[model samples]
Target: MKVPFNSKDREVCIIGLGYVGLTLAVVMAEAGFKVTGVERNNHINDLVNSGKAHFLEIGLDARLEQQVKNGNLKSVISIDEVESASVYIITVGTPLVNNSKTTNLEAIKLVSEGVAKRLKADDIVILRSTVKIGVSRNVVKPLLDEAGVEYKLAFCPERTLEGKALAELVSLPQVVGGLDDASTMRASDIFGFLTPTIIRVTTLETAEIIKLINNTQRDLMFAFANEIAGYCDVVGISAREVINSANIGYPRSSLALPGPVGGPCLEKDPYILSEGIKALKGNPALALLGRTVNEELPKVTIENIQLLLDKKVTSQEKLKFTIAGLAFKGRPETSDLRGTLAIPIIDEIKRILPNVEIFGYDPACSNEEISSLGITPCGNLEDVFKDSSVLLFQNNNPAFEKLNLNSLSRLMRQNGIIYDLWSQFDGTSLELSNGVRYGGHGLMYLYNK
Candidate 1:
């Protein structure tokens, strides 16, 4: 693709300062564009204005502060800024509707409505959020028509991991689709600053489906990993070890270690795709099944704990458990617990053992944040282990790797269970410590053998 516009001089306006929008805006500003971030909430506005990031991204705050101080980035709570921007990108939330496959695109609609009203001729509106396939024409373009504006429209869904978003934005190739050739040209030109390897689809629907398919594929793979873990549990085999050993021969088919696949995008995108298929009068059983398996993992992981502890029933007040890592992914050290698998597992714990004194200790989580979720904030690792009857490890953090068996053994009560979600410690060492009981997705293989 050939660049048509002056990519370096483009004034980029991003709507919604969320994990997606905020990162895109910062990266654009860093890429030498005059970036204007339009936010609706007062709290988000305050954070951005103060040069502080609302969510966790690797080095996002320092980069945002540097760009803001350099006069390259500025945020405002207004749609009026659209008049100055030649490119408008939408990166709002598309939440799931409880157990249902449908998505709530209210944020997308509102942004489309607001951006449509402020559209000028030749200005390109790019939908960066994942939505139903027909959103570009059935929703966005109609709003622009209703506003009586002659503008270009495109869908260039976000394709970056939470922790590596900044690096991937500049390194990964982008998928773009526009209403017309002219629209595609304009979007391609602007995005070329970030990556020149752009794949243009024949229709906006294709672009929308492409993004959905990418996440759907990952969701399915994670589900397979979980099912394999289930089999490993039954056969007394370590699924992680088996997977690792298998990778030595057929390296291409290696899936991520079995864990909860919870995060805003991963958990929601597959449902949206499934819902779209349902609307088209097709049975999306496989997609729905993948979602079910992943969502059920946290509960299943907890169930594995019950069997290991050999406790039929327990009170919450007497039980103290700790979740090691909080962020969905392993890097960038995020504080975003939204749709995090830990939320559901913790909720299940409360339901079964209402009196269990649940203690959450994540280096990324603040006391106020954990308190808001009705959990006691244990700021230190030692506190997490102090007299706890049970310890639950939700994520993988290097801090958990530093603990010695002697240190862990002294922290628990007699015959106390250690629920290791990420296999935080050496299973053999933990089991040999005498008082400690080790349980995880596939820990049975190490000791059961």
Candidate 2:
């Protein structure tokens, strides 16, 4: 196996068999490369070795199985199992340090050490993990340099949605920036085989900022929409209505609808962006502001629910609150719940409300998976809303939109409230029963009054 670079060895080692690494390993193997994936987690390694994906993606499991059976790809718990490889790609998680603004680079550091132990001259080391600026040079470089071996290093970020990783990985333009021009060319040459377009940036820091800025800007957009919702709540209006009307055939003001903005990257990248900016003696005011707004959206929305409940429900003994669409997003539909807004909303509900029975339902997750969120798994649509005090829609799963809520609301307690974060249903078509109310996320004020 030979890559376009002046290297005959096309053996590739991918560290961390998570979403990023696993998808990349399979794709690379499909491209006629002998790929070996390394994961420290026994469970993930076992699953990958058995040709299964731990989480749900559209067509990941089938591709994984084919790759494994063909002997083109395999997963090992340690990199020492591999004799040698021309390319080593690190795709580990760079989660925040104990829910703080700083990124925890322990995974990146440890993987770098592992790659260094098996270091070879002219080997290409690509960092696909999200990190703050200067990490590629300051963190990974020193560790690899200690091996006294020459290697090409680059920062190539992974920018694909959870449910659409495989397709997008091959279609999306791969951004590659390295410590030197030769390193950048080497990375671009390898990634060029995956996608038709290759974005060659000047420096690793430039490539690092691209991912953070893209996600932070998206967070800021949703924050503005949530702020509009707050304004509408105060003035007795609908943020969804106003935004939809404004953006209708209008290109100037492209406003996103108000909803719980939570996913792994969107929830975490703003902090990484601000941290990078602050390190350079600059204030990322807008980025951090957006982060704060999105972070508080769930907590504040739950508080509003508490206010709405206080006026409607009189019985406190057997109160039942149901949550539908538990995943982070519902459009593409996924089972991943890493940075979901459900966590904070549940926390606020438990903290402010008393003795409430919380029911969980998801179109994309199993009952056991829903129970992992610390709520009772709802059997079905009817069971979820049966005698429930409040029904909250967290994500925009199509299952919620197809339901006849008018019939379901008939099963709820009197003055029952259905609040949709994505505003899938138009209240104009809903006919209430027993004083039941169905309202969009931003128009909760209409019913709370």
**Can you write out model 1's per-residue Cα lDDT over 1-449, one digit (the tens) per residue?**
32234653378889989889988988888778888999988899889978999977768899999988988788899877544787889988888778565888888888888887777777788999889768788887887777686888889989898878888898898998999988887788788878859888878988999988898889998888888888888888788887778777785867777877878888888888887877889787777678888888877877666665555324443666666666664455577888788888888887665656788878787888878677888868888877777777777756667777576667767666776766656676454344666667877655342
Off by over 4 Å in 2: 1-9
> What value does the lDDT take at residue 182 in candidate 1?
83
Across residues 1-449, which tens digit of lDDT does each residue of candidate 2 receive? 23444445478899988888888998888877788999878988889989999888878999999999999888888989976698999999999985566999999999899889888888989999999988999999999997788889999999988888888888999999999999999998888778889999999999999999999889899999998988887788878889989999997989988888888899889988888889999988788888788889777877878887888877668789999988888978798888999988888889988679899999789998888989999998899889898999999887887888877788999998888887788776678787888875688765844
**Which of the numbered candidates is closest to the native, going by highest lDDT?**
2
The parts of candidate 1 lying over 4 Å away from their true place are 1-9, 81-83, 311-317, 431-434, 445-449
User: Which model scores highest in TM-score?
Assistant: 2
**What local lDDT does model 1 show for residue 57?**
74
Error (Å) of candidate 1 at residue 313 is 10
RMSD of model 2 against the true structure? 1.9
**Pairs with backbone N, CA or C atoms under 3 Å apart (clashes), candidate 2:** none
Q: Which residue pairs collide in model 1, if any?
A: 316-355, 316-356, 316-357, 317-355, 317-356
